[model samples]
Target: MNSARESLEAGYARARQDAARSLETKAGAVGAIATEGAGRDIGSTLLTMDSRLASLRRHSHDYADDLFRWHTVLQWLGWLALALIALKSFLYVLALELFHSDERMTLGFDDAQPIEGSYRTGAQLAIDRHFPHPLITRKQLSNADNHLVLAPWPGSSPLVRIIRRRYFFFARGSLLEDGGRVATVADTARGMVASAGGGQSIVEWTLREGEQVIFRYKDFFGASDNVSLRSELSLRLSTLLFGRVIFHSARCDSGEGRLLLKASVEAVDQAQLRAIPLERMIAWSRHAQFTVHSGRTPWKTLVNGFTLVRRDRGDGQHGLILVSSEDTGANTGSLRYLKRIFSSIF
Candidate 1:
């Protein structure tokens, strides 16, 4: 600004000097017997005046150009700031969605033949003809897979179904109603074994080398009382999405044989997951990871898989059904993500 002002003022001063000189020459020519010789060439004088006027115009243009450049620079900076703000807002929204989410998973039992169905998360789940709702009752099933495992879909909005959603299981001559016992689950060559009650009831499962494509729990219903069990089994292995998962819930109903399970779940390993997805988009639910452990040593450690202990004698007595969310050992992954988010915000 200072430079422009100085240059512009100099240009005006030069023009004024030329005009004054020209006026003096013209005055001499107007007088009779003029003193100044030839009144200083009129053509030369006019040329000088024109040149000075041009220089003034150029200085004015330069000042205007400088102002215009500053304006453009400011506009670009403003736009950049706004774009950054928008991007940050979008990321925060996605994080909040994951936090508020409670993925749905429902694993139950049903009788009666299932209605015709497809294999898509958004497709209608084939409803059991005898039982229409999502329930598990160990009754006589007619030509249908008894286990009803609803797939885990983190995409579904729990808020939409928040009115009041609860699941139920009716067990006749089964331990599901009794909440079972707390036992140690071990993975051995014989099969996956869940031992509780000092070896009173046994639950075991075995799998082949490959994954199973199509199988039903009813076919092996009388075979075992265990599903796919693994070691250091975190929810990370599963195809899970939205949700700050806290704890997982599972129920086992042993009926046909003294709660006697000696079959391998690996045979139909794909089947349980398939059943979960069996009515996913249609039913929406999600649980399978557990923090329940052997009652012998409380809070010290949890058995690798589901714990099968004696029946609950009182309301909060008996076994370990609930897993504390604050358990760092069980919730390492969940806590890490939460910590990262809060750290950025605060």
Candidate 2:
């Protein structure tokens, strides 16, 4: 009986040992499953990160491309601007060349009666014709404005001249004319007068029984002495003729002397100087009697003169006449004609 009991106990012990090994194996399997799930989660996270990084790289590349395109466009725009500036400069030079190449002169005339001869006396007519009305009353002329002089010149004659005797000082002169030449001269006792532009000498001439004349002489100090003289003469002639009509007529400047002649013949509500179409006036002048004269002199070397005349028809419009001259240098006849025409008009 004892032997049978021992065998059964041994068998039961073996069975218990087998059951413990099976539980251990099952625990190991469960731990392996948990580790595998954790690894899978980590792989998924890494994949997602890689995808995001790729997307970021793509966006960065697109941004770089856009920036490069903008830079290129800016460079092209800069080149275009430079080209436009160059073209404008070229056009301006061409225009200046064309303007200097043309030789033309302009004259102004009044349709009223001739100023040379009339039924008027000498000094009385001069006063009535030349001098503008005094701006101030006799009382104002006596006031203490040293800048303003009561009388431009202390003379009984109608004509007066304003002179600049210093770098920027002003004086006066008076003259009388006999026939077509200036006879008498009087000047204020002052030092060398200067002005904003330059030094100036002025003379006033009273015709025997006609209009008074104002002659202004400007002397510039520089390399352009000759050019200045020519410009001044041109300006004087222009002033004599058209100064009473046009508000701002054309001017001539030759690197030295600058002359400005401004007139407004609109005294009677623009009666004398009406605004006619430029094209119509040009056409009329073309059809009118035209005469051209060309000559050469020792000084000028080359010269050209043009004269145009149109008689008064039955129409109410007044007749038109124009005379112009262009000389290279020192032929004074054209200058004389300019003076004559101016005298006739004024």
Candidate 3:
């Protein structure tokens, strides 16, 4: 815009100079004619030329004013756009860094009603029930809990809602980042599983004699799904993945610097889900499991969801595969849908 204005102004100055020089030459001619006593007849013509030159100058000035106004407006709009982009970026970063919250598993014994049986011993019985073979010593884990404490995961809040709605890519990138490191396609699959698996408690367990508390999957989250979890690691998921799998029930035992985790994957069919009181769609999604048809249409197979697992124990999805998405139930456009899309693809 500035360049165009300068070019126009320069052209106008050159034209004005040329017109002035021509007028001076004409004036000399008129003087000569007057000296010959023949200029009186053309004096009105010179007046008309002068009026036309003034009009041209006025129009050139007006043109420059209009061009300058346009340039200013364009510059303002450009700055406004840049400012909006920067604001969005700042909000996104703030949401990720400032808003992440964490809660861990602990013996909330201070509830202070009245103590009955030993909660730690009760925790032991619960673990034994979940794992008939007992992978850990009775001394390792005695804490009663489950459904990996949603630590470092944003809870229900206004900022979280805004991020999900307006700044979703930031959240998505963070979720994928949860999937640890990746070097090969196999490593990528493992990282993706870890991402989908979601957050856990600070009390990481090792099957050996460790001072951490044990919260079996049953005590916490297994009751919601009503499916019996197997004890051995990766005991249930040894086949192909043709649906978005939710590692809803995982029994992880930390052993010898390695984690042995077991879980079952289920894809929910909301349509066939039976409504339960206020739960409605949520109840259906929770109670039911659906199968995806991975037939001739690879596109549908992908859209529906699936995982590509290698035929090795240590190759895919770490020791277990599960991805969790917030099931904020609704008619459509839930976080669950986004989780399904991402978990299926990666």
**TM-score of model 3 (CA atoms):** 0.21
Tell me the tens digit of each residue's lDDT in model 3 across 6-54: 9999999999999999999999998897776656556767899899999
Q: Whole-model lDDT, candidate 1?
A: 0.29
Clashes of each: 19, 7, 5
Question: Which sections of candidate 1 miss by over 4 Å?
Answer: 1-38, 41-48, 102-346
| Cα lDDT over the full model 2 | 0.30
Per-residue accuracy of model 1 over 187-279 as CA lDDT, tens digit each: 111211122232122221221212111222211122223322111112221212222122121222221111112122122222223221111
* lDDT score for residue 209 of model 1: 17
Native-referenced Cα lDDT, model 3: 0.30
TM-score of each: 0.20, 0.25, 0.21
State which candidate, 2 or 3, has the greater lDDT.
Answer: 2
What TM-score does prediction 2 earn?
0.25
Q: Using lDDT as the measure, what is the rank order of every candidate, best first?
A: 2, 3, 1
Each model's lDDT comes to 0.29, 0.30, 0.30
Clashing pairs in 2: 164-193, 165-192, 165-193, 166-192, 166-193, 166-194, 167-194
